[model samples]
Target: MRTNLDFSPLFRSSIGFDRMLNALEAASRTEMVDNWPSYDIVKTTEDDYRIAMDVAGFSPDELTITQEQNMLLVSGQKTNGEEVHYLHRGIASRSFQRRFELADHVKIVGAGLANGLLTVDLKREIPEEMKPREIEIKTNIALPKAESRQIEAEKAA
Candidate 1:
């Protein structure tokens, strides 16, 4: 199933938003999305986010997290310890890698694994210069002393 989204109007009206629109378009075209180690994205506050994934068999040492240019990569690989033969294995022990495309200014705060769940925290920090500020409009102007005296003399006469 294909859902068409037209961005021609956005391109004509907006500036410096082409990257965002392109990312959206690429995300929409992505196929065979990974479902392994199910995860949830939660908004803890206005500029904070939390991502929790089910990593039952993976340990802290086996997992690796890295961030580069607005992209977050998480991978897990089980080390070779001892060989074990199981009659019926229910839990998956295979290595897997997950990629998450984060928005601009978003940074990973921390990550932790607890109770078969791996949670990653993120925070968005916009620079002070980029933040909106009130521009003071100059509405008050002083008249020259000569012009003020002339007007007063005319009024008196």
Candidate 2:
């Protein structure tokens, strides 16, 4: 006999099972994506990041970079002629499109394919309005409006 388990409470909190499930689903989907193109994302600084991918057989002319709907998409297709292959094959050369979900205000700086590795640099620009700045207050003033106004008037008279 199986007993019914209530999962209603899991959805009631902020970091609930829903968020976990979403993260899990995203991770699983990304894992199952075209594995021929593997990538690494690293945070280099406070607001800087780098995404490097292994693209051994791909050339700079075969790759494309685009940003659509806040997603940074990197795709590659090798037009370099295909050889009717041998008894064994290791390097993969076809076509692939890899997408990364970008956070708000995160932008792609540029991309380059070098030495068989494609590097895509990213920068998160926090607007001056968003970054916190120190605000100072002068609370030791002697003038309290009414008295200061009377003193100004007396001086004027």
lDDT of every model, 2 decimals:
0.90, 0.80
For model 2, the stretches where C-alpha displacement exceeds 4 angstroms are 1-33, 80-85, 142-157
Q: Which segments of model 1 are wrong by more than 4 Å?
A: 3-15, 136-157
**What lDDT score is found at residue 16 in candidate 2?**
33
Q: How accurate is candidate 1 locally (lDDT)?
A: 0.90
**Structure candidate 2, residue pairs in collision:** none
For residues 70-103, what per-residue lDDT tens digits would candidate 1 score against the true structure?
A: 8999999999978998999999888999999999
The candidate that achieves the highest lDDT relative to the unseen native structure: 1
What tens digits encode model 2's per-residue C-alpha lDDT throughout 1-157?
4344444465565463674555445555424545668889999999999999999988888989999856888898879576676798788887899888887689899888889899999999988899899998888788766643434444553
Model 1, backbone clash pairs (residues 3+ apart or across chains), number: 0
Considering summed lDDT, which 10 consecutive residues are worst modelled in model 1?
148-157
